[model samples]
Target chain A: MRIAAARERKHDERRVAIVPDTVGRLSRLGVEVVLEHGAGAAAGFSDAAYAEQGATLTDLAALAPDLLLAIGPPPGEVLDTVRPGGLVVGLLGLATDDAILEAVAKRGLGAIALELLPRTSRAQSMDVLSSQASLAGYKAVLVGANLLGRIMPLQMTAAGTLTPAQVLVLGAGVAGLQAIATARRLGARVEAFDVRRAAREEVESLGARFLEVPLDAAEGEGGYAAAQSEEYLERQRALLAERVAEADLVVTTAQIPFRQAPRLVSGAMVEAMRPGAVVVDLAADTGGNVEGSRPGEIVETNGVRIVGASNLAAELPTHASQTFARNLANLVELMVTDGELHLDDELVRATLVVDGGEIRWSRPA
Target chain B: MRIAAARERKHDERRVAIVPDTVGRLSRLGVEVVLEHGAGAAAGFSDAAYAEQGATLTDLAALAPDLLLAIGPPPGEVLDTVRPGGLVVGLLGLATDDAILEAVAKRGLGAIALELLPRTSRAQSMDVLSSQASLAGYKAVLVGANLLGRIMPLQMTAAGTLTPAQVLVLGAGVAGLQAIATARRLGARVEAFDVRRAAREEVESLGARFLEVPLDAAEGEGGYAAAQSEEYLERQRALLAERVAEADLVVTTAQIPFRQAPRLVSGAMVEAMRPGAVVVDLAADTGGNVEGSRPGEIVETNGVRIVGASNLAAELPTHASQTFARNLANLVELMVTDGELHLDDELVRATLVVDGGEIRWSRPA
Candidate 1:
């Protein structure tokens, strides 16, 4: 089988699905590796590097490989280049990317949506969502600190003692936990809040304070947050407002999978924050966890800066691509049986959104 | 006595010599505080905040107080606004800002050049250079990390283990030491170089390895690096080339006081570095320590980014202003004796550059 990857076409998408290391990994599995020219340029991988690892560089349309890998669903034109009955694997958003999935089925191709990968111990190594979200959390703290007028760590010098900055992280999922860890590493006094009481253990283990609000658990499937009623959300926001006002830097990552992010901070809460405070909303690509956050733009209100982080993971393109490529390689290894392709693995059954000429996805009950 | 500060005219100067907290401190010293409109605005302090601390806000020309405070030497127009025999105090560069000093004496103003303050224990609390350089060092690492494509710290994610970034610091001054400390705080493996062998203790104390080039100590006055011969510099650069090539990030802070900064990283050495490596030159304002570094801008050569960081402490405006104002407050307190001004203190004598139409400054023997 021939495996290929093409350059992502989105203006802000900097990650590449395949890297030189992974090309070598797949080639060792007895599959031909091919990639379009300049595929990994944005992620700091040169075409020469891939070629040196024994991958062929050519136009995606001309190659027509048996398997295609991508960071996201490729454009329709690029998808049409794949041979009939071939396989496509990527973060095909099961809920939001209906148009692309429809096109995938019409083209008589089998597709593996990484987003549909089951959250089990066996699938941990191939969890792209967890891996990508970890990077986004790390980037959030750095971006917030850069934008703030003050420094993060407390400083004691000849002039005087400068107290450490107060950092508040909303939600305790993969992204939020990473943000807490990063902030703590920078010597910030970090506090995190999560409706899932189980997250408190992870937050406190990172040397951060876990805030407790008087509410029931909002646990959903696969450890993601469940939807809340308007009454519960309003009460929760009121409780969080105090913490928001006290923070020097706030990173909000309260995203419900495949749904709008819960609004944790309101405009009034932001106004109460001190002048020069910074708030980074990692959920801006969704509806946002903070009011007044605009995707892909930084806006200032009442002397506070609100960073609408659209793609925080993409900022660290090199490492993001490397980790993602490793995850993809693991899934590819599962599809190979006795040096030939097989679709019998449990992981394949969980992630395969489309069988040849048929769509296999259904809404969760 | 009346003390006044005006808004700095330089567009890039975000620091203010006075803050609201310092205004309260100065007021408690029995002096009238006057300020030009929006004097502290750029430093994240508001006019309302200053007024609340008992400061009088008006135009600089209108105030014409008994003492004038500034971050740099005031221009001829601002000097003209000060009353005859008034005192002007700030980080006045004795060698470069001669034109302004001449204007100060011609206007019969006594000026305190903070840069000329003797490095003694008595003057430690009032040492603005140390205070500001410390912030510059902290900011250099942040700028370098933000530009690079990889994370600074080591990670053992399920995808794999990522090694920590190797940070090489070329200088062991207050700024360089701070850079080492900050990088260590972010979990990067750090190595530092300094001509003064005494710096080894401080570097190691901050959990960083000190690179010792095969050279004798070049210790200068006041713990600064002394001038070196051309042959010595060439040998030093050759020794450092290997470390520079291995570093994911390099922050250069090797500046000789009142002299052009020493050239450290040559262009040839930079070309040998990996793609996406970042170098932040803290001495860019005087003269860059790295070749091809443009002051106040980021330039790219062979896919390596060179950030000529001019006034990096200004990037942390709020905290910088707070520390700077506190230092200035300490110096102001030394000038006052029992509700009256005194010019007899050792710090006052050392820092007072132009005293009543006469220049007390002579080159240090």
Candidate 2:
């Protein structure tokens, strides 16, 4: 069976669905990997690298394979060029991709939206969200530190002693924990907050202090954070504001899936921060965790910089694409056997959004 | 005794000669501090902060005092506003600053050039070059990592293992060693090269491999790497090119005092770097260590990013200014005894570039 990916067309989407390392994995599975010319250019994967890995570099029109891969959902024009009844897989933002879902249904094609994959240990290797969020968490601290006016680490020089910066990371999930780890590695005194009590051990394991909030049972289905009431959010923000006022760098990653990001920092809180303090909102694309933050922009309030970070993982395109390809390759390992594809595994079945002229998945309750 | 500083006017210069922390230190020395309004604003110090430390904030014309402070050389008009025969201290770039030197000499005023200060144990506390270079070194890695297309650290995620980046730092001087430390903190495997054989121990202590070239006696006076012969530089470049090609990030900080920075990474070497690799030249302002590097700009050659980092310490203005002010204060401590300024100490005499209508110091032999 042949699998192929065209160059990602979405602006600011630097990550490709395939990398050279993953090409060998698919090739080992008796899969012919075809890529459109310049498909991995933005992600630092040259066509030569793919060719060296025994993958074919061809025109978009000639990329009619049995399976099509993408980072973003491929446009209808590209989808129409796929082989009849071919399968397509990507981070199909199912909630907002009605047009692609309808087109796939009408064409009797198969679609696998990785975002809908079950968050289980058996499917952990294919968990793109966890992988990408970890990168976003790491990038958030880097972005904030880059904007800060002082060094993150302390120095006792002949000139004088420079105190370490105070870093406050909001959330204790994959991204928040990674942010804490990165900040701690840079010698910043890190403090993290999360409604999920179970995250405390993980946060402390990284040598960071986990701050406690009074509310409990904020854990949602699949170990993700559930939405909170307005009163709970108000109390949480009140506690965070005091800590944020003293932070040199703040990275907020308090995101609830398929919902607006919880606002954890108020405008007054940002204003209270000293000049040159930086706040990076990892949830900026889905509303924001800080007031006055806009997607993909930096807002300054009273000498404090609030960066609305969107698609931060994509900024580290080479590694982002590497892990993304590996995730897809892992799923392919389960489905492809004896040089033939079978969609029998429960892990594979869970990711199927559209198949056999019918929509297979719906928004989880 | 009174000391005052005017806001810097040079383009791209963000550091102030005095920070609020040093104002308190000076105040205890019976020195009445005066500052032009917003003198430290660019460095994140406010008038209120200075005022809290018993410093008077006023207009530039009204800052008549016994001593004037600056980051860059104060322009003629501002220098003319100082009290007659009063002292001025700053990084007076004596060699190329003919106009400022002439003006100071013509006015019969005393000037201290921090760059020319003796590098001795007694003067170590007042070593502005080492202090600022340390900050620049730390910032160089940050700037390079920010531009890189992959994460600096490694990760073994469920998706796959992401390898740590290979960072090559050239010239194991103050800046290069700091860059190595910062990269190692971020989990990058660093390799550093230096003409000075003595730098190997320091580089290895920071958990980085030292790439040694078969050379001897490269060390100059005062523990600084001296200028090398043309043949030595040519041989060094040949050795560095092979390592530079394999690095994900390269930071070059090989600078000779009062001399052009040696070209370590040739244009051909940069072109050999893979796409998305980054090179930050800390000596960019002093004729770059990398070929085609323009001061204060990012030059992309063959898809490799070459950052000509000028005044990197100024980018971290808060800490840069804090240490700068402390250095100046330490110098003041020895010169200003019993509430009066004296120019008697050998260390103080070593820094005097101009005094009594004559240039007191000349280019080193």
Candidate 3:
């Protein structure tokens, strides 16, 4: 179907919906690709590249396509260019922003949020959050490595054998695994932990050690960790005091949907660790896993440095934009037909959080 | 050589250096084992069981074995019972404690800390940290699942299609991978990341997608991520903001040796996420990955919950203790013989952080 990919309205976003390579892939799937001029410039894709790939180069007003694809929710002015009854798809956080919801409703536009897609096996290929989070996870480690003072792997040189840096990862999702594998490859002794009992094998298979504890039954369900009872937490703290004190580096990535971050690290724990240890808090933006964590700030306490960096994925814009563009392309391939659009696909239906001019799935309000 | 298995000093520690079954293995190696009353109680092993397996039950004062085995460092009074020139092996953080070092010297004893074992191929079996960390990783996800407010997997119930929770893991080490696999088994959509590019395959092999990024050539000699320029960090942050905003749950696990945690998440990024989201910082002990994280406290900001619970491994102490005991047992099997000890093995030499010692391997002044 015909889709107009507009420039991302969010400042500092280098990603674009329709990269040149994706335009060719979409063209093969009978889709007409439209690009806002220079949309892919920040990502190193030129407008001419889009034209070479058979995409129609046109202004937003001239190319009033039936569907709009964007990296984020379209800006207000850009929404004005949509034809009536058109569909717009992107990362629409409809639960919080009334303005965007109101804008879509006023125009009777069908809007779907990639972020709102239900996480399921069948929907995995169309999941944008997975795609982007993977990128974020990969980047977060690099950010941490760059900021850390010492090297990760052990080295035997004529001067002396340099012991590998000890790395502790806090979570075991995609990003955490990547960090573990990455750290291990770099010769760093990597260790990680998560709240999922089922994660032990995967962690061990990677050659990294897993940290275990006697968690309350309430701490686990269906393999995912549940919010712990206060008593369970106290016991956890008492048991973990020594382990935390021994680690050289720590990375924390633990979060639950639409909730505040769980405090896993304490000031006492930080105090217990040796000075100059670095912690990368992936949850800094949401809150932090560390006691003195501040988003986008480097905090030093008792000679220990805590860096709260936000948007780790954005740090690697080139690859992030490429992956995002590919994800968008896959999503478009699911609904495009003969250079036109079909909004009836289950993939589209499921992710259509704001359709028929109303907020259909608003995270239970 | 002969060795004495002592009672655990910590009240909750139930594991002994040798289980009944393993005692058979040790006896075959010409090792004589002595038990001190109730060493294996927590692991369901009785002194009779050890005796049945060819271990001798003896009083500490009479045993005066060449090797002493216990779950933590040998208590001060217990050191007095060791024969001069005897060996003591366990999970000892001697480098961090002057008391432990002094005790080893005062007693003229050879002390091997399992935690200090080098991350070498030969030391794998004796690696206490790896064994325990692996279990900790598995349990962390279970803990998170128990604490999570929703189910991990998708279900097609007659009521409606239940959506799987979106789980984001912060680190990619052993604990992180276990968390990913555990979450996946429970039906949650799991995503993970790490700094080292080498982790991509491990993450993908587990059915989770790996996030890729454009990283600088900052990897250290052992494939560890080396520190990067500030410009690189800014770029990274800009990219991760959107991904963090979309995740329902985030688990952070990033730490550097001898340093404070690096802040991976920003407050604005957390604010950007939908309310009611949850974050668990596994690095809560050494500080956290979230901005407003507090150790052992669940902080809510603008409708989001931040849980900074440290020492997740301790939450599953029963299993943790079991694994730790197994590791200790394996280590004890390496040097104890005929109710005696041998301290000349390469493994012992490398792990003996304090032996007739005075800060054997002190941190740089």
Highest DockQ model number: 2
Candidate 1 per-residue lDDT, tens place, A1-365, comes to 78889898888898999999898889988989898998898888989999999999998677687888989888888888888789899998665555676788999998999988888988989999989999999889988988877888999988998889999999899999999999999889999999888898999999999886544544435222323666666676676888899999999998877787888888889999988899999999888888999999999997799999987888888889999999999999989654477889999988888899688887663
Worst 10 residues of 1 chain A by lDDT: A218-227
Clashing pairs in 2: none
Q: Name the lDDT value of residue A3 in candidate 2.
A: 89
Scoring each candidate complex against the real one, what DockQ results? 0.75, 0.82, 0.02
Give per-candidate clash totals: 0, 0, 198
TM-score of 2: 0.94
Candidate 3 residue-wise lDDT, B123-147, digit = tens = 7766766655554454455555444
* Residue lDDT tens for model 3, A1-365: 56778777676676777767677877787656788787776655667778998888877677676788877778877888777888888877553353677788888887878876778776676666666665566455555554443444453321123366788888787667766765665456877788785788888887889877664575456223333556655665665666667776788878665666788888998898765477788878777888899987889886567878576655544445656667777777777767666778888888886676776765553
Q: Which runs in model 2 stand beyond 4 Å of their true positions? A: A95-97, A213-236, B214-238
The top-ranked prediction according to lDDT is: 2
Candidate 2 chain B worst ten-residue window by lDDT: B218-227
Better of 2 and 3 by TM-score: 2
Interface Cα root-mean-square deviation for all models: 0.8, 0.7, 17.4
- In candidate 3, stretches whose alpha carbon ends up further than 4 angstroms from where it belongs are A59-63, A94-98, A214-232, A239-241, B1-365
Ranked candidates, highest lDDT first:
2, 1, 3
